[model samples]
Target: MAKTLSVAPKQPQSCAALLEKLSSVLPKGHQFGIYHLSTPPTKTDALCHPPPDQRPDRTYCENHFLAVTIKSESKPSSSEPHADWRPVIVLALEIFIFTTAYSSIFFVSKADSTGYLHLLNLPKGTPSPIREVSSAFLAYLIDKRRRKGIQTTVNLFARAQDQYLFPGSIKNGGKHVLDDRGLVKWWCRVLDPLLEEQQQKQGSPWQVVKGYLLIPGLDHYETRAFIPRTATSAANWVLGHPLEKISHYCQEYDWVPPRCLIPKYPDDPKSRYRDELDEEASNKEQNSGAWRSVKTLEQFWEMMSFRQECSSGRMTGFIWVVFDPKDAEVNRGRVGGTPMPNGTPDQAPPGTPSRNRHALSSATPKSSPKKTFGSPSKQADLGRVEQKKKAKDKKKKKKILKGPIIPRQPRIKTRQRNYLVDRPVSSAYYYWPAEGRGQKIVDESDYKRCTELLLRLDFATLDKAAGSTRRWIEEVGMGSQWGLDVQGKMEMPPAAQGSGTAAGVVNNLSGLVRKKPIEGSEGQGQNGAGVNMLGAGLVRKKRKESTDGAEPNTDGSSHPAPSTAEEPKVNMLGAGMVRKKPKLA
Candidate 1:
């Protein structure tokens, strides 16, 4: 008979122990347990009603025990075997969720309903297309600046909004929800040049009109939308450098006269303390010599670089300069040469080996010292630094001689293409001093014709805001004959052809014209019969000439020439006679 074995059941661990044990055994892929809880089947009940053998796991409870089961990966498999890349699937899902959330934040924060409408109107799944279009637009702006030898920063979103919105709306606007902080800052960079141009035009004898920086955007409360920069920074950005770095560059370079001269040795040992003397001497030398006179901006840069190089002791001649091994490899197996760093120059830097200087010449200046393991490398470094300094100075001087490498002003590229709206063009026409002449009104007929032509012209452009000139012409009431006729109302002829509004306008114009000689006194003549006839004729002639294009020569033979001694002084009482007695009278 087989030895009797006790069938005692294994003891259950405490809930805490069981939980810890379960957590450890469960693979990350299998962390999820059963989907829901249900009443457990008792051991006796299982005997009466057999349990379903298809359950994945035979879970145990106080009343029952169950067996573990394996799951099939797929419903249909060719070989009845499938690979479950659970880890990969789980990782991918996590990444998808994270990416979606991140992208949503950028779009959802401040987007206007109109913006969404616009997005919807776009061909479905158009973000990719829009991005392409935007990229192209940005590239065009960049290329435009480049072609003009300028650098600028542009924000496509802001430009797009500007194209759609009216200037007054933008100016007196509330906050926009979709203003991206980065994009706004970028816009400021682009607009730097325009602000600079404004500053230059209206010389800041007092305060300058800083710039039109939008104060409210999505984060208006956090950061101001627009800010002005020094003219230098503006110019730099227009030329394509980052605005933040522009100021740092300006501070580094001090302006003065230029001369490439050897450093002078002091006359005494105490020369170290003679900075004041050196400054005075330097100034005096610079002031006296034509060589030192720096006329252009480039020369100022050269002078500054020269000063720095000299003071830094990097101006010593020919020392072998080794860059990293990678640079050496790039230079075609050469280990050392001068590193000629300079301001923007199209040519290859000086001290570069392509110009044919021996690599051995990169050795440092000879100084007597003990032959030690560490010394040569240290000497080599010193040599390289000295070489770098001289090379830098040479490059700087070359840049200076090139003359005003940076343009004096920057240009602001217009926003994206748009059609102008709402605005109309108008003008105030009257005679004033001509180009060093007496005065003449512009051709009223021609002006009227231009106004009419403008009013009827079509302005369906890709850039609506950009087509503002069209709007300006329209809003200002500058158009064809009709527009001019309306303006003519301000000074209607004594006889108006039409009645009602047009006639009223013509009457108004007549009134304005009749208001008279302003503060100036009228012409006078003798009181005799001859003077009366002459004065009446003159008055009538002037009135007729005002409307008709009857400009007369100043030296017309109608008036008598002045006698040299008496100089034909006007009679004060007659000259003081005013025209068009005031209505108040």
Candidate 2:
């Protein structure tokens, strides 16, 4: 009940007729041009040999070879219609080259069948001629190649717009080409299906092969057969050969020598093969930006092995495959009830919750404190308590002796000078009396006598007296008493009154002469020294009494009794020598 499908066959065109058609459509003065260069006798004999057994059968394809070249007129009149056809020719050449470069080769069994001559690979960007030809010729050849199970090497550098160059394009006739590492990954993804189909077809192991071919639009071509190797030795042998050795082998096999194999061209200094000896030097500069330094063949092979392992999904030692418990059980059950491999445990029985074995194994256990055996004796306990009490009492005594803590003021340590050694006895040693002291001490004789008294003191006593006096002056804002200036001395408050060294030194050194008490001076003390009590102690007493509502007897006579806050201010010298005030009242 099957119906026979009949198709019309394509008619062939003569070479003269085809040229005439192309010339009519081309610009004025432009004609189809063809040049034939006969191959050398040695190369012709090599080409006549049959292809290797591993290669695809090409018996169905036409063996006839022809090379087409279209030449454009060199010069044309500017005024002529459409005179400048250079741009058009260039565009057509690009299309022709790109199409032929990537198009698959086709084979025909009949001599009369249509087939366009395959062009040799050209160097990239090389100038070429073009002819106005139908793309139908290319489509016909690809169709025949598909029906005959023939394929061409992949073109990685083809234009992106050429969809047939892509691996999964419909125009590729379901054939694949592994041209790059990315396409290798694509191949790996569907490798299981490919292998299953191959097994089903009972095909030879080397029946299908991937090709990596790079053909620059120049005389040079690079091609490699990607035969699958079952043994590691075979793969290693293929990849381990040096590029130069491989080029030499190809030359011996009647293949055109690659740019890398040729001797340096005398006329062309930029020739690629001109400097083999300089490779190491040039590579040292060129590989500066490379990610890895590949210096040894062993290291290179190791890196390649790692990359191949990664690409083929063989590096699974670090990859853990976790599965749902239910799914894992189902998979295990489907596999003829076989136990899980690699010590993988089976799912827990129904109704029993699964425990996380990893979490339990990794958990740390808590430790408990150890216990003592017996209680201490009462006597020992009492002795311990007594010792603790004694320690507390000691701390209390130390705190009491330490007195109230005072925060230390920030100060810079300065170099201290010893007057006895650093300098001779000067006026700076004289005791400068405090405010309200008797005028007798201000005399030059009194200052000299005071300095002599100070110089006579023992070393220890002199040091004590100097420290106390320096501290008092610093406290009372009278550092000039010690011949110290504000810029050179530390600012500090006066010392407390418990120490009497400073007061004794000031009293003796000043050579103060007490005045006789005048009549009517209340609370006057003997010796009339109360008036000279203008030193630090008396100032503190007067300040305290004044705050208690007592009028200070500035006449230097005696301490006054508490009185009313309102009192007339009196100016007085030591020993009640009162001075008269202005009568503005």
Candidate 3:
């Protein structure tokens, strides 16, 4: 029987028993159960009735940190376990958290360490423990958060690398780890099933499981393989990266720099030690370096390029996986918006109508302005009204949007492809600032089509993965414009458009049902990696056939010939051959 998932394992013994089965693949001491690094959230800590100051502590979604270790232990050509089962890691997880009744989760960075985490090779056809542990834990976190009644989109980065636990790629003989491209696909495949969890339910909070990939200097021709990536007329989904915030600040202000060497934040749960360091540095006047001299985001990236971890020839993919809430947009920017410019004139705000041109055109002309000295309240109210009008005018002027010179689109002669020329960068083996500028605003239908295609893709092999991408573009791109003006009053996502939403994973004793495949996706029941959309963990991999000119079995796998072995007393059965190692020799 397939074991069901539990978001929060209530019985420690049962959880321990289950984990013990996976002990060989789990990191040492972490094999038993999850270790929480954060305090539980409380109800009183969420957004106040009327939204209060935008601070992390009182945010609607509370951020939390989680860490886990896993690795695939494949055998080498020489009939031994693949070397490099353990290599020094630099965490690719995704970051950049939460507490209120609703907790937002992100993997916290494990500070400054470089080393290998040993791997124990499991029986052949076993999936990589690394992907398993990571996926399972992430699913657990999502589910736990869902149970808390916190419905918000979850955002995190997924940069693929050999390992993510350590800072630098240590020189290890292990070459079994997936490369950057494979890592991204592998992550996608790993997380793809999560979508099934939401599609299974009518009111499932986890609505989408979309991915946004930004590899610098990649052109449309190259990037077309990964859905529509750059910004177009429709919706610019390629929101800027988090690191660029530092740069934005520098550009806006003559910002005195902090320790820019590491991308640690003061409120980061794991990196609270940064606060102590800041205090000490201030007391001793010891904070000084090129870090202090930095001014712009470009300089930040330039410096980041030199870091031991990033300098490696391996390109780090800037990826975003957003588990969006259909009704709950977690971003504080749009929440509790200011009542939309105070509605129409009839149901106008409960104040003196403004003397602005728009209001004056409709307002009944007052016979004479009754500005008596006795009525200070009216005068004061009028003065306040004038200030608000002035501020509104300034705001409008500041954001004066120039309408398109050619209002309606010119009639298509043959058919125009998307305008794919986003600002390209000069790739110089470094992470440039604004790494995620290639934006695209896919329509809802296109977005759904692309995500479905991506899920159907078989990333089992390079050839399959390539073929899948070709199929994806051919099918999803047919009659689909990458740029289309959003016409409806749709609940569209902001700048980060390419993502699918999956707010929480199935954490408890229930399996998610995969949604009925849409029309064309029915035949696309392809599989990648050893994954079940239900995320029950430890699924068996379908081993490949040998390339040595042997015919594969009817099952698409080649069975190894059994070796003959002698029984000490009783004779062993026919075909069950297992011989004493080279008896004559």
Candidate 4:
């Protein structure tokens, strides 16, 4: 019965002042009507429940005004409809914490260990083609090229590992330094082959160049001899890495190596090499825009020319003249003292003179397989027999292939239903006529066939038939709205002729003829028959068929009349086509 106080939600004051007034204003049960304080402009509704009998009557006394203030510092309810207030302290504190965290932290990927975490922007489940293709290419190269020299072999192995393991890491300044023990293990395993090759060629020109190449100006004068056919084979296996991955990585990174050195022929002067280098620089950069490397081993192999069991090619900047085991059948068997199978000629060691004296005594003669065949004269006969067998096979193949029948697969028929067709004739093409009278529902087979036919017909006819069909469609509660008959040539029948109600008649007839439409005498009436005849007339008219055969029953079903209906006098629309009406009994 006390006045309802519209106290603005709790207003804030200093802590001490709030406490001093608490006792005086605390509500009801105990000392005062005081409650918590909040900021200005908020509504504070005091929760006033009816005083219970257990409490004193002083609690009901309205004089104890509860200071139930709405505080700005209180947390908001998650379910609250609207809370727009943000205190200055909260805003300042949030900004301070965010700035502190952001400055102290850097984002790290969950895939940091995989080295390809940067490619997360790419869609998940997409495989990296580069890694697989490069690895396959490496295996193929090694199996084909057997590099002998330790230095070249070790470098090739190192390059392969670099390409496969880290891929694009080298271009980004990642050092290739291995741990102390790892370095020793690598040198022993990979470097031993090259060192032994070096040792074998100690007194040769290889040793001379090895020492002189380390000196200053003489470095330019040092000659690089032809890589032994064996050595070249091994070098090709390692080239796959540079060709496949490095080109793309370097091209993207803009880290393409410059062509600073030029190779000279064995007899060409050091001056000539330097001169060609200068001319190359002066030629306005012939190799600047295009890729200077082959970019792929497949390209290298395609460009290769073979010279006596070895394949070699100059790919823009670098010249790799090499041999591979796969390239020659004879060399594969002969390398490393492996014996050639019988009937293959063995080349005498580089420059050894023929030891005819030792060969004659050591030779062991045996009769040839041909000599043992029956008689000496029969050898020629046996050769003829083999030749005739080959000819017979050729003749047999020709006869069988002369006119062999190849059965072609039969094509499955698929009819395209054009739902978007806007033709008048298409409307009736796939139409489902209304259920027969007295039948509760349409026959399933009939309905399915009709639906399918509608699905297959041309769009234009469907467009024309749609008008009559649309009404049938609705009455039947069929699948869709009547397709548009954009041509608008659908005409009212002569029975419904000149009647202002022809449109409604057409709608009724169309509905009746629509498959599964309700069976009743409604569309069978005179109005419905007139509309149906009109539609049939339009179809016959379009095809230039005689409308003479079409007659509408009292039920509006269109049936072909064999010359029984009387023709009404009508205007001639065109050749042999007259607009006429049937005699109604």
Candidate 5:
């Protein structure tokens, strides 16, 4: 073979080069800008920042954008304006992270989409620019919060849609665009890498991510707004995504976890945002518990389908990044002196005198010995002894509660986990959940082959883009390194190629979902010859003629007589073809 030229991946694109590249790839007059809410809100102008986030931490993730655009007349002739790379208007897609009252508690609120996305008229598929910018900002928040020793959880919704801005998107979903279901998988792929990165570090407390789906009419009947005497119905339905990757991840943590989805407390501003905007409904749900009548997490998602957002034409997905620390006490098991679930120390039964204090205790006045005639000094000594005993009892009661002891009912008033048990870090109380041996796959070779290969190629330069298109096809299409779980073969070095969009077929979903294959189907199968029958072929089956004068049929059945004339055995052309009957005068 002629000496093969090695083609390496191009260096990372710089900010300036990236801006220019994005400007060219994206439509004219559009800029790929990023804006985020500044902490303390005071740093950002009032236009970008809103009122207080109603959070104790003084952190607000939502900020509106001014619909400002650069006119062609005012646009700079040179690339000087792109040098700063700072956004004048940030399209804020809000993701709030409120630490709630405790670590066990988390909040995921959904509001109307206030993002200034009108500027972006890109085609279908969640663009990498949007994904990267949004993910990076949230990742920064999570990292910042985690560094401060706060538990971090991420949340997002999945609703596959064509370009919300472009008018042509309605007619053309564009090629290779992901659908609603695929969007769920795509997002998981996008975020899974982040979770893995965190895992490789000091260990990410979040090990699981669950997606709750809402499909109206298909899941449950329409969730009509009706008043109930009791809070017996729930608006939060829980039809989770059917992706094995997430299900397996969840299994590793809680095999059959309690279906406790998002909690919708009465008038809870943090949980119900968009729905609570209706003052009448807010007050009604406040009184009726938001119709939160679902008994399990699964039911919550089923009910969610009835919402206007997830009506007959739309589907909504709610995702949660679950945080469960590995150092949870489940592995070591609770040691002695572990306080009960309540803030109070492990209780002694009411019948047990050693732990329980009853009315018959000696501390009561009735238990005191009757006053008897005695010296004045002896009577004074007895009174002083009673006072000392009372003081000692008071001291013991104070020790029972390490801090303020608030009695709570199950989910309502439960104390934090580990109670008073000590840990390496005082704030590290994440020792929670079961210790079952969940399915653990240490090897990530499949992740590299399956997940990593599915990412979109970077298109910093035009020539590189065409070459990458071919390289992606050759490496991925051929299964150059084979097998699902086994280590793939060595990656083939990139070969030299001419510029221009690579000429090849691109297989896609074709606006159809893949289902289980028939027993034998040439039309289906991923590895089948990429061919389809054009309406089951053009020819008709041969027709049989009926006998005019028929012989008497036997009990079994009469059969057609065999041809008596015989010919010399010889290979003949058109021997089996049916000939048309000739017409004669």
Candidate 6:
């Protein structure tokens, strides 16, 4: 007969053994919780059961719960051989749960009527995944707590709730929701203090704070709390350049706030957002009042934070020199060798001597005739030699007097074209006097120094200096036309008209005829008065008669005219007929 093997029923696995198995398989940095189902399926004793309504109701229990929360650990238990296997099973389950959670967060097959949550597939390279996960976990925790009607508050949960909700709504917590501004504010509340602490510890401001603040969602809070107090400090944080360099550049270029020499962060998204914000603010101001009318710290921050578009294909921090029309005219004057109005012939600039002086010096002096008893041939030779010498001297004098023909400096043809090869001289080369007559000359070395300094300045430095300059302009009452007009109220005589011109003559004659009655001729007949009409015709007649040698009556036939000293000076339509020099005494 075949030997029969009897098998005993298999025993249920112990919880410790299961836990050990889970611990072994789980990946590092992962935690898993295990719970037993409180409601196990039950079999009914149908034979003894009465009718359905009279039978004990077994429809459903009001509450189903999990028992014993257990977490998987990375370390294996030494007491059991299968300890390492437990965490692996737990890790697999955890992966499934994590994937499910992420999928639900991103892509939902159906919409929920609750309206508290939304599902959106985030763009490929967003930084919101971690935050989203945290939010979802918080939501789950809040729901669990509410279901239990628990009144206890977890500080971490409270903080997360505040970060996820609108300001002042955290205490009246409901569901966890993401509020961008609130999140940014929360970040500032945490990071700003940390930045300050780091600054204190390092004995200098932290540059990383600027980078953190400029991250897309966080930059909105720049003016709200995190920006450095001073422009120089902000520059140092935003741009890795010295404040002095920026200030010097601004001073050189005369660039005020919102008109920096260099464009900053033109391609950065944060910068772009800041620019949008600035543009919005600018538009609002324009609509509500004057554009950029109010100079506040808020405005300053907006201006500094804005990024300019470089359609010119220039690099960030590139220096652009602008030549005003007046500057170009002045430069042209210098290149053309024009003499200074105040300077005399003796004081003419070198290489540009006075033309009159040159003419006088170049004239040939007359030579006395030579008295010599010489042969005819010798005389002829001597004469020829003298003529040749004279001609040579004349040519040399012409060359000397005319000097070198220095060509005019070439002008930049168009404003749009950049002069990469021929950059403009720096402001230091031209001294701007407080009196504002015009720029004066300076040494070449100073110009070079200023140019190099300006070129070295980065965007942030220039931006900071611009803001400071604007503030200074405002403080000195030069920001608006009204303030400038008030400062420019000094009286000045009306500009003189061109008296020699026909139009000017007519104007002057009309004024004289209207205002002044001709002396001793008031009662003259209309015919005689018609000839005496104050105009170019009468003036021309008087001039022609004077030039043709007509003499003024000194025989007292004409009425005694006013003395030259007493006669009022008048234009007389370009004719100077002031009572012909009164015979002395």
Q: Model 3: per-residue lDDT, tens digit, 97-161?
A: 33332324343332211222333322233344456555554565555444212333333333444
Model 1 weakest lDDT span, ten residues long: 89-98
Question: Cα RMSD (Å) between model 1 and the true structure?
Answer: 38.3
lDDT of 6 by residue, 1-585 (tens): 111323222332123433343333322233434322111112222111111112221211111111111122223433444554221110000000001100000101110011111112222233332232223232222222121110111111001122211122223232244443354343333223323433455432112322123321124344335433543334223322222122212222211222121222212322353445446565434332222432322343344323342222221121111111212222221211223233343442222222242433333212211212121123334666899999999887754446688889998767542122122211211111121110111133332342233223221222222332234223322243211100111122234222223353334465456556578777778667535457553553221123346675556465544343233345354444434667887
Top-TM-score candidate index? 5
Return the top candidate by lDDT: 3
TM-score of 4: 0.15
Off by over 4 Å in 1: 1-120, 128-135, 145-176, 179-473, 476-585
Q: Please report how far candidate 4 places residue 131 from its true position, in Å.
A: 21
In candidate 4, stretches whose alpha carbon ends up further than 4 angstroms from where it belongs are 1-585
Of 2 and 3, the candidate ahead on lDDT is 3
Give candidate 2 misplaced runs (Cα > 4 Å): 1-77, 81-87, 91-206, 213-585
Alpha carbon lDDT at 407, candidate 3: 60
Worst-scoring 10-residue span by lDDT in model 6: 93-102
Weakest lDDT window of 10 consecutive positions for candidate 2: 109-118
- Rank the models by TM-score, top first: 5, 3, 1, 6, 2, 4
When 3 and 6 are scored with lDDT, the better candidate is: 3
In order, the Cα lDDT scores of the candidates are 0.24, 0.25, 0.35, 0.24, 0.33, 0.26
Tens-place lDDT digits, model 4, residues 1-585: 111233222221223322332222221121111121111111121111111111111110000001111112113542322644211100000000000100100010000011222222322232222222222222222222222210111111111122222223334322243432343233222222333343465442122111100111111222122122244323322222222121111211212222211212212232243344346453333333111232222332333222211122211112121111122333322312233333343442222223343443334222111111112113434666889999999987854455778999998869844221122210100111111011112333433443334333221221222222233344333454321111112233344334342344334476457555445655565545433335433453212234557543456446565464455556445544665788899
Candidate 3 residue 142 Cα shift, in angstroms, is: 1.2
Candidate closer to the true structure by lDDT (higher is better), 1 or 2: 2
Q: Count the backbone clashes (under 3 Å) in each candidate.
A: 39, 13, 37, 49, 14, 14
Model 2 residue 133 CA deviation in Å: 10
